[model samples]
Target: MRRKARRRRRRRMRRRRRRRRMRRSRMRRKRRRRRMRRKRRRRRLNWRLEKRRRMRSRWQQRKMMRIMKRWRRKRRRRLRKRRRRISMMRRRGEDNEEWENEEEEEKNEEEA
Candidate 1:
């Protein structure tokens, strides 16, 4: 009977140790899940930030394109007027060296 009791005590001790190990493993799993959830949230926030940055950059590019188009139209109109003036000066049989220089400069600017 004493031997049986000793065996039972040993079995009970082993069961308690097993239960403790199980609890520790469960706690570790919970901690890992929490850490993964935090990482996912951070990734989601970063994705949103990146999307916003791209949208802003695209908007800026569109704005710059519109400004460039407007500038091009204004330059063409000015060049047309200068050409008309140069033609009129030529018809009047006037020395147009200054106008010719200006026209050459405008052409160079357009080439650039």
Candidate 2:
């Protein structure tokens, strides 16, 4: 009877140790899984933010290009109008004095 009791006590102790070890391993696995999940979520959010930034930059670039094109077109129109006026003055037999006066008036207007 003494030998039997000793054997039973040893078996119970072994089983309790194994149970504790299994619980510890399960907790470790759960913590590792939670950490992986958090990392994935953060990576996804960062990717989305980067995509939005790129898209916004592209839109701004397009808007600037459009504005520049419009400004160039207006400059071209103004130059054509000036050339037409100069030709008309020359056809009317106007001298360099009138042309110089017009240039001074334009300069004053620009300064104002």
Candidate 3:
């Protein structure tokens, strides 16, 4: 009777241990799966943000180029006008000192 009781107790303890190990393994698997899912979502969001940033940079570059082109065209027109005015003044035999003073005033106005 004593030997039979001991054998039965050992069998019950072994069964309980097996159940505990199985439960622990299941919990670990669930935790790992959740972590992987979160990581994947974060990566996707980062990729979307990167794409938007690249698009914005491209748009800004194009706008800057357009502005530079317009500025160059205006400068060219202003230079042509100045050359014509100087030539006409020369033909009219205007005083050189007066023209120089006018040029200095124009430069000051532009600086202001």
Candidate 4:
């Protein structure tokens, strides 16, 4: 009876040790898998952020072009008005001292 009890106790201890080792290996495997999944998700987030930055930069470039075009058009219009005023003044001999025309000579065309 004493030998049978000793054998039974040894068997139970071996079983408990085996179970503990199995649980530890299983937990280690699960932890490694979780870490790998987190790394993949981080890579995906980085790609998405880069894509958003490229899109935003493109939009900013387009907006700047629009503003530049509007400013150029306004400058061109002002230059045209200034040139017209200068031409009219030159045709009236306002800038020339010897090219003066009589007022009665400019009124002959209105009578015709």
Pick by lDDT: which candidate is best?
Answer: 1
Root mean square deviation (Cα) for candidate 1 = 18.0
Local distance difference test, each candidate: 0.87, 0.79, 0.79, 0.72
Candidate 4: tens digits of C-alpha lDDT, residues 8-112? 999999999999999999999999999999999998879745555565577776776677689879866765665566567788768753223433433453363
Identify the candidate with maximal TM-score.
1
Error of 1 at 77 (Å): 1.3
Distance (Å) between predicted and true CA of 44, model 3? Answer: 1.7
Say which prediction, candidate 1 or candidate 2, comes out ahead on lDDT: 1
Query: RMSD of each candidate?
Result: 18.0, 20.2, 19.0, 25.7
- The positional error of residue 103 in candidate 1, measured at the CA in angstroms, is 2.0
Clashing pairs in 1: none
Name the better of 1 and 4 by TM-score: 1
Task: In model 3, state the lDDT of residue 50.
Answer: 57
